[model samples]
Target: MTSAKSSENKQAFINGWKQSKLVRVFLYFILMLVFFLSSYQHLIVSDKNMGENTSEKEINQETPIYSEYSINSLDFLEHIFDKLEQINLDATFTYEEKTEIYKLYFLEEYNKFVEDNIKTMQQSEDSLDAAFIQEIENQLIDQQYDFPVEAFFKLPRLSQAEIIKMSAVAESIVKNLMKEQIKEADIMRGKVAEMVNASNLSDDDSRVLVTEIARFSIFPNYFYDAAATKEALSSTKTTETNYLQVVGLILLVILFVVFLYMYIKQSNLQIRNNNVQLLMLVFIFIINMMGMKIVALGHSLDYPYLGFLAPVALGSMLIAILLDYKLAFISSILFSIFASIIFNFENQMFLFDYRYGIVASVICFTSIFAVHKASQRSSILKAGILITIAACTSITAIFLITNENVISNYIFSLTFALMNGLLTAVFVIGILPFFEAAFGILSPVKLVELSNPNHPLLRKLLTETPGTYHHSVMVANLSEAAAESIGANGLLCRVGSFYHDVGKTKRPNYFIENQVNSENPHDTIDPDLSKSIIISHARDGVEMLKEYKMPKAICDIAEQHHGTTLLKYFYFKAKKQQELTGELEEEVKESDFRYPGPKAQFKEAAIVGLCDCVEAAVRSLSNPKMDQINTMVDKIIKDRLEDQQLNECDLTLKEIDTIAKSLKETLLGIFHSRIEYPELPSRDKKGVTKDEATVSI
Candidate 1:
C-alpha cells in the first residue's frame, strides 16, 4: 500500500511537470536551438571552402606590404615625367643625341628607383612585414633599368609635336591602367591590346608608345597577386555565400521551426504533452539532416548531379508515420529547405533557393501525402514509387529552368531521382521500427495487429470472462464509429476498447458482467469491499498492459477510461444499509466509493471512456429502442461533461454531440433485430430456433 501511494504520487508529479508552462517554453527553445545548430555548420564549412580556392603555392606566398618604406615609391616620379619635353630636337641636339638624351630621363627615373629600394631595405629586414617587403625591395634592386634603345630610337625620329603627342598618350594609358589594383597580366594585356587595335597611328608610332609604356616610361608600380585575383572573381559570383546572407537564412529557418512548434501544439495535443515524443521529433529531424549530408558526398563524384540521389522525402515519411501528418506536412517544408542547402549547386543558402528546393519540396510532399494514412509497412515502398514519379517531373522541371533542353541529357539525373525514391523507402523501412519501438508509439499497423483476438491478453479475456469480452467487443464497435465521426483514430479506439476490460479477467466472478449464473459476490461482502474490487480493475488493467510493454497510449486509455466517477451502485447500497442499521447516512464517505482517476488527457481516451459507459448502460435494457439508445447516450455524455471528465481533452461540445449521435446510430444497428423481436419463436424444420439459426458456428 505504501509503494502504491508513492508510485501514484510520483506519477502525479510527472504529469504536473509535463503540463507546466516552463517545460513548454524550454521545449520550444530546444526545437529552435536544434534547428539553428543544424544550419550553423554551413557557415564553418563555407569558410573552410574559402581557402580551397587557391593552391598551396599560392596560399603560402608572401603578401604585398609596401608601407614599410614605400618601395611602391612612384610618388617621386610625378614631376620627372616632364623631362621628355625638355629636349631641343632641331639644332643643339641631333636626332640620335636627342633620342639618347630622352632615354637618359627614363634612365634617371629608373636609377632613382633602384637606389630608393636599397635605402628602404636598410631600415627593416626585421619587421613583421619584413619578408614580403624585402622580396619587393630585392626585385627592384635586381631588374635592369636600361632604356629600350631599339624602340625608343623611333621616338627621336618624330618632330617635337609628334614626340609630345605620343609621350602624353603613353603616360595617360600607363597611369589609367595602374590605378587602384590590377591583379593579373591578362587585364593589362587586354587593355593594351584593345588600345593598339583601335589606334589609327602608324605601326611605327604605336610600337614606339608600347615600348615606352611597357619598359622605360611607367614607374615600377605594377604588381600582380594571384590570390587577390581569384578572391575578387569568386566574390562577384558567390556573394550569397557571404556571412551576412548565411546568418539571415539561419534566422529564417528558426522562424519556420517556431511555426512548426506552434502547429504541433495546436494540432496534436498528445504529442505536445509528452516531452519524450517531442524529443523524438527533434531526433527525427537530425537523422534526416544527417542523411542529406551523407548523400551530398556524391555531389563531387563523376556521376552527373548525383545529389539528385539524396533521399529528400525520408524525413516527412518518418514523421507521418511516427507522429501527426499535419506536422509532417509542415516539417516537409523545413526538410526540403535543409536538403536544398545540402545539395545546392553554388553553395547558396537562401531559404527558397530554386536550384534544389523545388525538386526536394515535390519529393517531400509526395511522400507525406502517400504515406500519411498508411496501415502497412509496404505502403512506404508504394510511397517511394510515387515519390520517384514526382522526382522525375520535378527534375525535368528543373532542367527546363537550366535550359538543359536536350531530352537525352536528363537521363543521368532522372535515373538518380528514381534512385532517390528507392533510397527514401529503404531508409524509412529500416529506421521506422527503431522509432516505433523506442518511443513506444502506437501506429495504425501496430494497432491493427494488437486488435487481433489471438493475442494472449485478448484471448485470456475471451476465455476467462466471456461476458465482459462480449461487452468489450460491443464497446469497440460503438467507440470506433464515434471516433471516426469526429476525425479521430478509429483503429486506435477499437484496439483500446479490446483491452480496456482485460483487468476484469483477474476477478471474473466479482464483476456483474462476468458473474454468469453464480451468486453475487457483493451479496456476501461489504459494499466497500465490492467497490475496491471494481475500482482495482481499471488500475490492474494499466499494470497488465504495461507488463506486456504495450504502447503508452493504449495503457493510458486503460487507466483513464473510468475517470473519477462515483460508483453509485455500491455507494447508495452502503448508504441504504447504514440507514436501516440505525447509522447516519454520513457514515459512508462518497470519496471512498469513487474511482481514482486523472481524467482523460487525450481525445481517444475520452471517446473510449464515454463509449464504455454508454455500451454497458444500453446493454442492460431488455429491448433498447433508437430513442431509448439516444437518451442513454446523451445522459452518459452529459454526466461526463458535468463531472468535468472531458475537461482535459481538446474535444469541443459540437464534436461531443456528433459523437453521441454516432454512438446511438451504432448501438441501434447492433441491437436492431434484438429490439424488433424480443422473444424466440418455435423451432424450424431443421430444429434450430430463429436466434439459433442466425448465430455463427
Candidate 2:
C-alpha cells in the first residue's frame, strides 16, 4: 500500500508539472532575456559618439536637457544678434555723432584727410595757433553738413570706444550677411538654401544659410549639446537590467514553489499509460520544433505576427490525432504566444493582431470534431483542408475587428491558410510511412487497400482456394462496418480479416472450399486429420504474419478469428458416416474437433471473429433476404456473446447492438436486387440432361 501511494504521488507530481503555468512563465522569461542579450550590440551602436569633456555630472545637471540645449544655445546667439540688429537702426545727426559712429568702421582715409588739412591750415595762417587750428578742425569734425560732406568736414578722429564699437558693428554686419539666399530664385546660393535658415532671407534662403552656418560650426559645444540630449533621452540611470534579473530570479523561485504546491495537492491522481503518454510527449515536442522552425521562417519573411498562426492551423489535426481536444486547445494558445514573440510585436500595421489567436483557436477547436478516430492519410488531408477553411473564417472575423482593406487582407490570409494546409498535408503524408513502419500506426485507408483480393496472399487464395478468398472478402466488409459503428479501429479489423485466411494459400487444394471440379479433399483424410489441417491455418497465419512483421493488432485478429470454436462440419460429417456404416462403436472426442485455445481479446479481433462466422453461414443461402441475413448475423453475435469472446474487450452491449444494426443495413444495401425478368414458356417439369444441369449449377 505504501508503494502504491508513492507511485501515485510521483504520478501526481508529473501531472501537475505538465499543467504548471508558473513553469511556462519562468521559461518564457529566460527565453526573453536570452534574446535581449543576443541582440544588445544594436543598442551599443546607437549610443556611441559623445563629446570628450562632457561629464556624467554635466549631463545630469542639464535642465530638461534636450529643451534647454536647444533654447540656451539660441539665447547666446540671440544676445549677439540683438546688437547686430540695432546697427541698421543707428542714426548720427551731428558731426560728433558721425565721428563717434564712423570711427566704428575704422575710417583711415577720413582720419589722414583731417590731420593733413589741419596742418595745411596752420601753414596758411601763421597767426593762427597750431593748437587753435587743431581745435578748430576737431570742432569742424563735430559738425554735420549736407550733400558732399567732403574730406574736410566729414573726416573724424579715431578713438578707443569708437574702435571697439567699429569691430562690434563689423561682426554684426557679417552675421546678418550670412543669411542664406534662395537657391532656386537666387540661383547663386545652390542647393544649400533648402537646408539653412535665417531671418533676413526668404524661406529657401534661410534654410541654406542655417545649413552652411551649421556646417562651419564644428566646435565641441555644437556636438556636445546634441550628444547630451540624445544620451539623456536614451540612457538608464537606475540600472533596469539588474532589476529585471533580480525579478526574474524571484519569479523562478515562485515558479518552483507553485509547482511544488500543486504536486502536493494532487498527490493521488492516476497517471495514464506510460507508453502512450511518452508517445504523446515526443510527438508534441516534434510538433513544437516544427512550429518554431516555421515561425523563424515567417520572421524572415517579415510577415505580420499572424504568419506564426500558420503552424497552429497546420498542426491542429496532428494534435487532435495524438492528443485529446482540451490539450489541443491549450496548445493553440501556447503556440500563439510563441508566434507573438517571433513577430517581435513591433510593426503591426493592422489594429487587431488578434487574428493569430483567433485563427489558432478556431482551427484547433474545429479539428477536434473533424479528426475523431481518424487514422488515414486521406482523412488527415481532409482534416487539413477543413482547418484551412477554419483559418480563413477566423481571419475574416478578425479583419472585421479593424477596418483594414477587406479583399486584400482576405486574399493574403486565404493564401497563407491554403499554404499552411497544403504544407501540413505534405508533411503529415511524408511522416506517415515512417510512423507506420516504426511505431505501427495502422491507418484506415491503408487497411482498406490491403483488404483487396489482389494482394499476393489473397490472390494466391483466389487462384488456389477461391472459396476462402470469397469468404474473407465478405468478412472484411462485415467487420469494417462493425468496427466503424462501435467507434473502434474499423480499418484495422477489415485488413486483419483479409489476411487472416492467408494460411490457406499454403495447401489450398486440401480444403473443401478449393475443390471446384473435384471430390472433397476431406474424403481422402480421416476426420481427425482434416480437423488438424483446418486448425493449423490459424497457427500458420500467425507465423506468416510474424515473418512479415505485421502489427500485433493485425496478427491478433488473424490468430483469434476462430477462437477455439468446434469444427462442426467435420465432426458432424464424421459422426454421420460412422452411424451410416454401422460403426458407432468408434469413439468421437471433442478435443479432435476444437481449434487451438484463446478467444478474441479486443474489439477488432472479436469483430473479425463474428464476421468470419457470418460470411461462411450466409454464403450458403440460395436466395437470402433481409430476414435470413439478420438471422445469420443475430446467431453469430449471440453465439460470440454467449461464449464470452468479447468479455476482455471494451465493447459494451449497446455498441454491439449498433454494430449489428449497421452491418444489417450495409449488407442490405450491398446486396439489393434488380427487377425480375418476365418468363414466357416453361421447360419439362422433370428438367434437362446432365450437361444442362451441370451448367445451371
Which numbered prediction scores highest in TM-score against the true structure? 1
Question: lDDT tens string, model 1, 552-630?
Answer: 8899999999999999999999998898898773689999998999788888999999999998899899988878888
Q: Model 2: how large is the Cα RMSD against the reference?
A: 20.8
The residue-by-residue lDDT of candidate 2 on 1-697, one tens digit each, is 9998999799788756655666544544543443343222212112222333222222233233211101112333343234323442354345566545434432343344456656665566334334444444544344311112232233333233433443343334334323321111112112223222212333342233233322222111111234345555566742454355446545543553354334423542111223333344345545654564555555434343446345554444555554344445544554554444343333222212455556666766776667666655677788778878877777777767775432433566778887776766677667655555555556454565566667666677677777888778788888888888876766777788888888887777776667678887788788878888889998888888888777777888888888878888889878876888888676777667888756876678888887787777776777778899899889888987886778866678998899889778877776665669996444556766666677789
lDDT (C-alpha) at residue 374 in model 1 = 89
Worst 10 residues of 2 by lDDT: 180-189
What TM-score do all the candidates reach, one by one?
A: 0.63, 0.52
RMSD in Å for all candidates: 15.5, 20.8
**Candidate 1: worst-modelled 10 consecutive residues by lDDT:** 52-61
Off by over 4 Å in 1: 1-241, 258-278, 346-355, 396-415, 437-440, 515-521, 524-528, 577-586, 642-644, 647-655, 673-697
The C-alpha lDDT values of all candidates are 0.72, 0.56
